[model samples]
Target: MKTYQEKRHFDKTPEPPWRDDQDKGQHRFVVQKHQAAHLHYDFRLEIGGVLQSWAVPKGPPLKPGVRRLAIKVEDHPVDYIDFAGEIPQGEYGAGSVEIWDKGEFDLKRESTDIVEFSLRGKKLSGSYALIHTADKNWLFIRRKEV
Candidate 1:
């Protein structure tokens, strides 16, 4: 099976969703940016056909029980990997975008309540999981090292 980046060629086409060359497939990746808030990172993973985004606040936690507040955003095109320029002034996410961490992930366990995956990223090296809460929001947590 091809990875998300490999399945979708962002180089040949750099259009957003709804384009003929666009891909609406699910994907998961991270983007490092020098934003207005002291240069934090953005970790986004695709789920339910939407890109579940999180601002990390301090990047991925190194230990378990570390819950990060993740803010869900609009579903971005799978071709977003090709985006590496400025978001332009007056635009949302107005900052420099760079591929921070990206690769195929294995869904070790998944359900409406919990989802776990082994994340392979340049900045993050460990297994990560997201559990749904009663409020309908999800809690992003790092799995304990075995």
Candidate 2:
């Protein structure tokens, strides 16, 4: 979370608490509707004790075979999975954030260029894949099946 820490003043923002002792056995995920400078969805999944994050401009696609651009972002603390509040003005993510979806996910396959998973959230429950396209750019696609 080096980049995540360096970008914000935790003292000023209501971001989730940073804990190096976060559990590693949990499989969690969250989609936050962030009304930041630009409206976008922050997609996060718990992996290796941290939240591997992405900024999906239009949110994740729910229909199979559909894709959305997911820009890779800094890894956040796993505690961020439940964070839903306003980030103070002048803060790194100065805006209101609300949990759009929250639930556990099953990671099926993973590699440097692709990650296949299945989400079991209130609003998102299906097989999906995040294909790394280029630097910091990935394609989040809703797969037809596992």
Candidate 3:
């Protein structure tokens, strides 16, 4: 979380501070609506030990066969899964944050680039794939039911 910590100052912001002893998450995921410089959805998955993050500019798709642009962001702490509040002014992501949808998900496959998963969330409940399109950019696609 070096990149995560470098962008934040724990003393001035309300964002979750990093504690190196955190648990490897239980396949949990979260989508946060962030009203920062722009309105975007922060999609995160608990992978490995940290929360791998992406900033979806147009939000995620609820309908199958739809694609949304997702830009890969820095890793967040495990505790950030439940984080929802305002980041103080001058902070890295200084804006109002709210949980859009959250629930457990099942990973079908993953690699350094692509990740295929099945989400069991309030607004999203089906198979989804995040395919790497290019540097720091990916396609968040809702897979059609078979």
Candidate 4:
């Protein structure tokens, strides 16, 4: 939470602030297309009380066997899952954000190196896997449809 707050000043940015009573026991997911220093997709999974985030450089692949680089980022507030706007210039992630896809996901498995899940979104659906490739680096792979 500190990392998230430290990156952006609440006064300058429109991003939501950290909330303690935001968790509703509902698992939600969001993929935000961010146009920042570089174009990337921000994938977030609602867990615990925050949103676990990843920055996929090339966006999520739709075809099976295709892998895209996903870099882990700071945990954002749960309220950020629905955020869509322009982050002011000079802010940490100064850019325009738009919701690309959003829905719920089911966790299938989780291990130290990999996490498998099923995403049910308007643009993305079916099983997916995130394999840890290096420290803070992961490979987002679309699993074969079953």
Residue 25 of model 4, lDDT score: 62
lDDT of each: 0.59, 0.93, 0.95, 0.92
Q: What is the lDDT of candidate 2?
A: 0.93
Q: What is the lDDT of residue 46 in candidate 2?
A: 91
By lDDT rank, best first, the candidates go 3, 2, 4, 1
**Over 4 Å off, model 1:** 1-28, 34-39, 47-50, 134-137
Error of 1 at 81 (Å): 2.7
TM-score of 2: 0.97
Across 48-146, the per-residue lDDT of candidate 1 in tens digits comes to 554555565556666776876544334554555455666554444555666666765666887867778887666666788877765535677887878
Q: Give the best candidate by lDDT.
A: 3
Question: What's model 3's overall lDDT?
Answer: 0.95
- Tens digits of per-residue lDDT, candidate 3, 23-121, equal 885999999999999999999999988999999999998999999999999999999999999999899989999999999999999998899999999
Considering summed lDDT, which 10 consecutive residues are worst modelled in model 4?
A: 19-28
Per-residue lDDT tens digits for candidate 2, residues 1-146, read 77888898878887876787877879999999999999999999998889999999999899999999999999999889989999998989899999999999999998989998999999999899999999999999999874
For all predicted structures, in order, the TM-scores are 0.67, 0.97, 0.98, 0.96
Give the lowest summed-lDDT range of ten residues in model 3: 16-25
